[model samples]
Target: MYVEGLLSSLTRVKKARSLRAASWDTTGRNNDAWNIEPNETRVLADIKGPGCINHIWMTQRDGYRNVLLRAFWDDEEHPSVLCPLGDFFGLGNEIVNSYDSLLFSASTAGNNQFNTGCALNCYVQMPFNKSARIELVNEGDEMHRQYFYIDYELYEQPLDDEVAYFHTQFRRENPCDGWGHEIRVNTPEANIVNAERLAWDNNYLILEAEGRGHYIGCNLSITNFQGTWWGEGDDMIWVDGYKWPPDLHGTGSEDYLNQAWGMQPNAFRHNGSSIYEPDTDGYQTSYVFHLENPVRFEKEIRATIEHGHGNHLRNETSSVAYWYQLEPHKPFGILPVQQRKPVLRGEDGGWLINETAQTQQAEPTLNDEMKQLKAQWAEKQKTEA
Candidate 1:
């Protein structure tokens, strides 16, 4: 939002010393990039702190979704940031469409390659008191040639005790357990006439953390498999211990991303849809950064969304949640490399339907009257057709 005078702070008396860790040719040659072999992990930045990482810029020949990016603060055993390299940068599903955002961006060669050479950057402030370690794990089978820079500001004084550590976690629900796949969205019969959400045990979880923290936002990616509009779900975020009624309940998917009607191909500083393929080949990527109003929490936060109205649409979904929290964070382990791999796109540039894909659907316990209503609705559809 600081559109005009963003550089005004540059004139202020700077107290911190600027520093950087980068991949430079030790031989003073132009071959500065490192070739990371399969399964090889490289330390991008390991620095002592009382420092704040101001910026990070990186590029690789083919840093697809299989590559894992992790960051640990204060030498913690578990990393605070763990996400697919591409998702962490903004785009998702290994499909790169470069766009600039306030916190993260990807710059491409203008060809719009699905997952190829691109420069990725992150400008989220990451202040650490003791130490910080950033590593990249090449989980794909091919060798990855990567170049990078981690710019930080070293402070002579220790960071404020109240300063929280930055954190990110990725999650995916390939073919989210959705009921009523046979039903089309917006159909009269598809309406939640008798539906009710007694609980959110089956919601697609974007983040579930147990600690003192504030959720900044998340990047959500979806590939429509149902052949129609794939965004009829609602966003429900629970901070502290509220159950049935969440702390921040949203109306619909597009509404949650700050769009109306449907998602558009737009990228702004705080909120916008980075990718919007709104057809049967629906592949959309959107983000919402709560920079001005972070969802604060004292104990915990559980952020989730429905796959469709009442959790009734089946589609591929994945996301990365960004936040800042205290140390000793709850361990949110990531999916295996195989599971984290991007789903193959069809010849038509849509996700290939995987019939054998496992589903995590949680069918609600329906009473006799509700079950009868559902059966009657099915029979009515057959008769109408």
Candidate 2:
């Protein structure tokens, strides 16, 4: 059991002392931030605990997706929580939006500026028995000044054996390995012979874990590449090594994020889209939290979603999965800093796919309207000549 809501548990006296680790100026000056050099890993909080982290608040200039946030539980060799600073807060793709959620939120004064104006906060409970080490790795080219507060509680008594350590991991598929988008969806040409998918291997993997854990939620960001509509992909999750026809299967991308026809600008306590901009050629960041209904697994869990129905659309996708599990978690390596940044769109208005220095442009596919405009423009040029 965790002491989460203050108003609900205010009457109960608890045997825990409140504490905080912060980046306040040591000399008591106005410069209350750490100047982290490029490639420097700064230890934000190193706490010994029979305790739980109650809250985390951070803000910095240029602290977009370039800065990495990591947390180690019980002095574990590998990090339990590893993600980009911006993605971990909720949105993705180096985007900043003002949205409020139950467990996570980012606030901006106006215009969504990153320099001191955009404040990121997390309210998830992170319990540890031996030690907890939280860190920030500056992956950007220049030194970044960061300020933060890791507020936690120390308990004289040991935590319950059933308590699970918090964990998170970020993943990305810059232009997912999807089939060509030349054919229109739902047509006979699009639904070719043997269209049925028998394996989940090709789906965009959101999270894969070994050991007992319950998946709490995830934030998914997608930059639509072959855009007419970019969200017909079904969500399929396998729990405990189940075979095909997963235990949890969803209808489509928008439905999985608790949306209907298309993504809209909305933010709710449990599910919502933080950034929904179609004018920017379909950049969407949405999240769904399993606060009341977590997906539990004993041995393993693999969470994924199709790019477009039957893996038919190539798009840039990234996500961060949050869950709680026992120690000795599976080590999932973070992508290099360059690869982690959002992939740039090529001149052809498609993703410039980069996989470990090998760069290539994805073949652009125009929608019906775009194709018509192209034809019209060609005719006009001929007439002028």
Question: Which candidate leads the pack in lDDT?
Answer: 1
lDDT of 2 by residue, 33-146 (tens): 899999999999999988999999998756678889999999899999999998899867776778999999987754333334478899999999999999999998999888
How many clashes in candidate 2?
0
lDDT per residue (tens digit) for residues 185-267 in model 1? 76664566322254367678999999898999999998777768888778899889766568888888888888888787688
- Residue 283: error of model 1 in Å? 1.3
Tell how far residue 45 is off in model 2, in angstroms. Answer: 0.5
- Can you give the lDDT of residue 193 in candidate 2? 22
Off by over 4 Å in 2: 1-7, 110-117, 185-197, 345-385
Clashes of each: 0, 0
Candidate 1 accuracy as TM-score: 0.91
